[model samples]
Target: MKGRNSIQFRIITGLLLILLLSVGVSIYLTTANQKSNLLDASQRTLAVNNEMLNTTIRNIMLSGEAPIANRTMEDFRKITGFLEFELYRTDGSTAFNDYDTLNFVNDYQSMVMFDQTPRVEGRSIDTEDFQQVLMNKTPVISLNEDTREMEYYFPILNFAECRVCHGDDEFIRGVSHFRISLDSIYDQVRRAGVLMAVYFVSVGVILFTWILLLMHRTIIKPVLDIGETVNIAATGNLDIQVDLDRNDEVGELAGRVNHMISGLRERRDLELQNKVIETRLEENRKYLDHIKEGLLLLNSERRITGQYSVFLTKLFMREDIAGLSLADFIYPDAERFADERRDLDGFLEMLFTNKTADMDMIMSINPLNEAVLQLDQDNEIIIRADFLRIVENGEMENVMVIFENLTDIVHSRHELEEERQRRESELEQIATVLKMGPKVFEGFIEEGERAFGSLRGNLTNFSDKEFISEAFRSVHSVKGTARYLDFPGVEEHCHQLENLFAEVRDGSRKVDKSLEETVAGTLDSLDDELVLIRKLIDRFKEFSVGSESTQVSPFNVFGERINDMVKDISNELDKDVVFNLETDLESVPGLPEIQPSIFHLIRNALDHGLEDIYERLAAGKPSESQLSLRFIHEDNWLKIEVEDDGRGLDMPALEKKGVEMGLLKPGVHLPSQIVNVLFRPGFSSRDEATSISGRGVGLDAVKEDIKKMGGRINIRTSRGKGTTFVLLVPWKGDEEGVLV
Candidate 1:
């Protein structure tokens, strides 16, 4: 049963089917050709017999013997395979009907002997072959399948001898019709087909048997033997070998099988030796698991080898670290560590490909050294990786990486650095507080609270120019004081608030919920700073000689404060300025409330309105630019002015900047309208901002403070002369130099 289903059996079955098909096609073609030849011979013989009958019939008609012609046609019809033999006249009428032509001739002879008119009725025949022969004057042959016969109508031409009796009006005298049976020709074809079939069957049987025997001897027997040996070898018996002994393909296949069997024996011996080596390797793996450090191997492809120390799994907090590339295992976040990953891939390529390269020099630029990795969410560790060249037979092979965990040491160093920074901050704050004194510090804290409250209030409505300016100025005032007092934390917080307002002013940032939230958050931070300063002041109070009642008056040192500020600002701006101070309201009411305005106006005049030293000389003015501050009380209004002999307002530049800042339409504007824009929030002509005046908030804040006091300012300027701001404030004072 197995041999029947084998390859040899299938191959022989397919070939046998092909052979049978070829034999069937050959028999069909030969039989058809033979039938065709037999039909041609039969047709030719029938045609020759028709010609002989025509000659015989013609001679009988010329003899004027109807009996002879009728008797001759009867004899031809009685011949085997000749069904009908008759003569047709030119008008498709038969020359004789039932021996009627003989009778008619006798009657006509009698009439002629009696000297009377002779007439005889003839039989007419209607047939396609007869009509065709009469009209065309040619022979017509047709097959009648129903009768298994062929009909031939041969035209008897009107010869010269026949034409003597017939008229010269027609070319054909009559047609000779013959109907012959085709059954005999078909019988001969059937017999010949049977003989050919027998011959083909015999040849096919002999060839099939011979080919099958040859194939079975040469291919099937040897292949079956080889298959049996292979099955035995598959069952773990490698001693079996094929015994086919020849020089053909089968013999070559058997030899290959024998060679394969020998190789299997050698493989069996090698596998036995490998089992011992595997046992030793298992022992080495157990030793590696006990090692403290993380150790792994990387092949030339940069993929981690299967064998690695067990510490890697614990260090990475995962178990599937083996067989991963160095990039995937160490720097798993591809986008975040793209540079480092590229470096690692290049380093690995160089290390594996360049065998003669310096290992130490390459190791110096290793990207993985002191690398930080996040193992899982919320768990990160720092590792210092070191690579060792793993050499095999004086050639570079795998790389051995040793990872040292440095997470704890790094965290300890960070904590120490933060501690050092905190101490330095505390020392600086102490020095600033000691220089400014507790009273001024306390006042500043109180003032910061009020400024923050105002800023927060204005944050609700940025479109109100007064509110926006108020918010801006509050922050600027706090920043200026904080800087003078060397309170860096408070100063930085104010600076951040200034930036937020500046963005809103210039139309770069919108006045939305986000802006309000950011401003509120920054103000809250400032509040926290104030709380911290309060704590520091309370501590200082505990160690001071004077108590809280020993407060200094701001009016007594007002001039000194203004002079110091001007000196500092001019030196910083690299400008030469001659400052003049005139005041008749020393004991004025609310001096401290408007102190920030004065300071802002001074800073603005020096920073924004003044040019450098070279501009003063080129403008035909004294190199020492003039700046003046005045205060006068008259008619219940205190008048104050801050003047600068520097460049006045450039209206065209201001208008252009206003359009760019989205504060004005892009067209002509009045100079007064343009000047009013100076007090609008965040409208600065300066492209970049500095610590001084580019923030576009100082004038806004100054205007906001003056508005709160029901006061107004007036500006006067010329092209190259100077610009002056005169501030008018309401004063309601009573007798005895006291407030009402």
Candidate 2:
């Protein structure tokens, strides 16, 4: 029963309930209305009959024809099928009775004496309607439940004619009572109710049957089919499709179920594929672990994932590296490598987002390649990293990072290179000594000794600009010759001495006792190396009378030496400098004798006058700074001009430095006075001393040497533009003939 209480059952039950209620209410109303209408009709009929009977009795009594009135009353009862009819007097005596009329009035003697004889005693009427009719002299009708009949009463009144038979004082003479049986009317009403009940029952049965069939087809059957399909689906039978070809809610539900099953089927296949991939990945991971090289797998986020090789843990010096961001381990200091981190982030972003594009170019310049890892404060390692993109399902998923430690390899290579260079240098030094014949070697040795002797003499008397200038010139001349002879050890020592003079000349280092000692020590070292070279030359003296020497112009040799010095300085400072010799070598006078002074000026210009490449670029100049040497003869004087497109002298800075050095007061100095400060013995503009400058000796030396040659040195400069140094010396004959 509970199972049967479904939508269909509920619908049917409700319909039946409504049908029954409607039919019952309708039947009740019908039966009630029928009874009321029948009662009304019965009362109206009795009223009319009573009125006619009263008129008849009144006329008959007036005419003294008692027998006719009695016979009429009798006929009314028999024709109308009334149960009883009686006329009673006011005193409750029955004046006329239909039963008596039938019994006596039918005979002639009873009819003739009906009005004259004593009134037959009426039944004493004590009913309320009967008493009302008598007292009020009006007609009354009522139903008798016990008899199943309706009784009617009419009060008789005394009129002028009725007074003849009765008394004139009486308002109502008598009462007429009539009773009618209700069996026939009740029978009609019962038949009508039965017919209506039959009609309603028939209609309800037909409607219920039609509705049951409609509900089954439209709602119940479809629901049952959906339920059964769902049950099958619940049991994992995804192949069972709900094929309800409807455009209703049920149809939509079926369509959703079908879609769900399709998704499930796809998911099952994908799960199986995932398992296969996982197995393959595990196998690959195991293989990778055995390899000696460090290997790590990183996701697109640069986070470490999956199993990593044991070597990787050893390389990074961390064991619990899995599931952490690779950036955290590699670039541990965010503040230190913030820019690199951003770059790496962008690199990974491109690798992940632009999966289909080739990443070879990006990987080639990757910062991690051949990066130096500072494992700790004391221990550092060089590593080469290689990246391989990992793609899955046609999309980039992860990156495989392979790290190779190159620290040992690099160190060994460096040591090997140093050893090879040492051996090569030694052999070249021996070969240079052998290549020169005894005469040329002797001349080279004699010139080197003269240059050293002059430099040592100047250093001993290094109190004034002339002595410093002579010392610088001697050292520079020796350095040039050694370089020309391919004597690297001798040349290197001379170069170091030249740098010391350069620093003193640039006012970047002070010429104190310590400076003198350093210069003396360097000169001693050079002397030792020179002696060793002379000994080597003597050892190889018998091997060859040197080949005929090619004659080169003295100016050409001087220019070449200057060129080499500038090149060397340029290389040391990592700057690009172009040196131009804009002079007629034939016209230059006293070239060999004044070579030291010219060389000093050239070295000074290279070390101080030219700006570094980066500074030149920032100043909107060419990356390679320019230096030009112009030699001209005018008015019996050889004017040598050394000009450079460099950051010119800062006069104010020089003045401030002069003030700080107690060379000048804190007041403005004339431009000439500021220029003269360059000739001040230890006045330097540079703050820190370098091997090249900040020793305050080069320009002072130049000035003194030019003065000794009976000439003058002057400088002209413009801020941020360039500087020019002009040496005006007396023109002498170029007695050393040009060999070119």
Candidate 3:
């Protein structure tokens, strides 16, 4: 109903109003004309009747037949449809009245003799018609609405015959007045008005019905169909169309609606195509993200703009890098790249500015190529960045930056190089040992021992600058001798020691307690290597045909070997280490089998337990750090202790490394538990591999070796002070007799 009240109702209502107004106008005009014609016809008929009556009266008076004229007028009045007919004298007296039977039309004495009724008496005689008839002596006509009649007054003019009776005294004789009822004409007009009203109403009804049907067919029905089709299309049904077949505005509207739906359907198909393309693009993005290499797209402004692989986020450690300047993302702090020549900013600027430049040349000089980014204090990664220029429409549009993480590759290369160097050193040492016969090898070993022993004696009298100078000279001499002997391993160790002392003597490095301890550790390592070389030579000596009678004392050899190994460690670490040989080696038995264990313990102490010279001093210890090896004969156990005045075990650092290696859970542990971490296979406190302790095999091997020797090692440590390792070997034989 509400929908119907809109255009359809308004159009029908407007048409009805217009039709009604037209009908009302037509009825008003027709009725007005009909009334005018009817009134005019009545007036003309009254005038003609008055004229005929006047002429008849004149003829009758001329023929001398007044009684006959009077009778005729009486009969005419009776026969005519007039309400009243009368004659009045000029003095306002009636000449003849219809109500009086004795009155005569032209009787001169009858007006006074008879009982006369005035024609105009008790009537409105002051009217214009009566005034004109009486004063001007002319006929006057007027209507009387109360009686529904037309009144006419005619002046009776004096003529020749009228003067013979009246003596010719006046020009006007009397007035004749007639009142004619217009009721029949009024009835006809009323009936005609009613019929016209009915006719107009009928025409309005028929026109209204015809208009309603035509509008429904031409407008309302088409609009409804279009509305329904629009509703369907709104529901995502673009196939709906209004099939209006007409050459009208509605047809044009239907055509437009069909075109709109066709456009909608095409748009929907395009949307589906876009959806599929977006899905494929997303999948491709995922694939790119998972690839090993990182990718970045930079616009012409050298800003990261378009899509980038997710790996780039991981590589750069940032997520919201799009729309950011490429140089800014790579190097956020400009001050860090202050060196203009080697600055990454210059490289990027050059590459971005010079479109036609060779990318290979730019890449060759690219500082970011194989750049090392320190992720944190303990973590770093090497990355190789490559830039490729993307050209579009003969212009450089973008640059694709590729980042490849080279940390593992670089580390692997280092490890391989180290391994190769180790193998070459070993083979060279073996070759040199073979080339130099037993006598020459023995001479070299004895000379090395004497030189190291002298250096150790001099280090005991530790001074600052003079002592460092002497140390450098002594290590340099030993290094030169080892080089001459082609003992590359010993030579390299001596060279490192030489470098340490040289740095100290030249003031490049401080000769603090830590430095002294470090030197001591390095010296100990070098001596250990020498001893191993000596042992190797001795093995070679055993193969000699004439070497069977060489009876060397085990006690002296063991003591000397221990001293050499400790001194080597002290020098190797660049420390001023004072080694005390407290054990009387002559009292020990089975020295040969226990030598390896002793060596392992001393090496472990040097590498893991001992502190550098600076650390010893910082701990309020001597600048010449102390390391002691002692042997004691208990009731049934042979005990050896190795202790150092150096930094104790870092239990926290050990625990952290353990957690990282997945060897131990994260928590506080007992000192013994922390110490046991040292012996866990493949667990080390060091974050990186080097020539020393990170292998994780040393302490574990030592523990196994000690266990095989029927000994267990115990560790004691004090924070900021030092550490001690005590080995207890069970002995069953008599101590005195077991000595060799």
The candidate that achieves the highest lDDT relative to the unseen native structure: 1
lDDT per residue, candidate 1, 1-740, as tens digits? 46788777787787789778887888889878987787777678778888887888778767665556766677878988888776777777777543554466667657546222222245577887788777787888787656778888898888888776566777887788878889977777778778878888889888888888888888887788898999999999998888778998888898999999999999999899999989987997997799988999898778998778888779988677777998988888899989988998998887778778788988888887878888878999999888887888987788998999999999998889867765676676676556445766787888899988877777778766666666777779888767655566788888888787667765789888998899899989889888978998888878876643453344444555577668878998999988888876656676656677777788888988888899888887778878998878889887878999889888888998888877888888988888888887777778787777788887877887899899998888776777898888887574212110
* Residue 415 miss distance in model 3 (angstroms): 63
List model 2 lDDT by residue over 365-403, tens digit each: 677776777877887888887888887898777898888
Q: Write the per-residue lDDT of candidate 3 for residues 420-510, one digit (tens) a residue.
A: 9877876766564454345445755665677677666655444465555444434544554454445667877776665565455445676
Candidates 1 and 2 compared: the better one by TM-score is 1
Record all residue pairs in model 1 with backbone atoms less than 3 Å apart, i.e. clashing. none
Global lDDT for candidate 1? 0.78
lDDT, candidate 3, at 210:
95
Rank by lDDT, descending? Answer: 1, 2, 3
lDDT values, one for every candidate:
0.78, 0.73, 0.71
Which scores better on lDDT, 1 or 3? 1
The per-candidate count of clashes, in order, stands at 0, 15, 38
Query: What's the CA error at residue 329 for candidate 2, in Å?
Result: 2.9
TM-score of each predicted structure versus truth? 0.54, 0.43, 0.33
Output the TM-score of candidate 2. Answer: 0.43
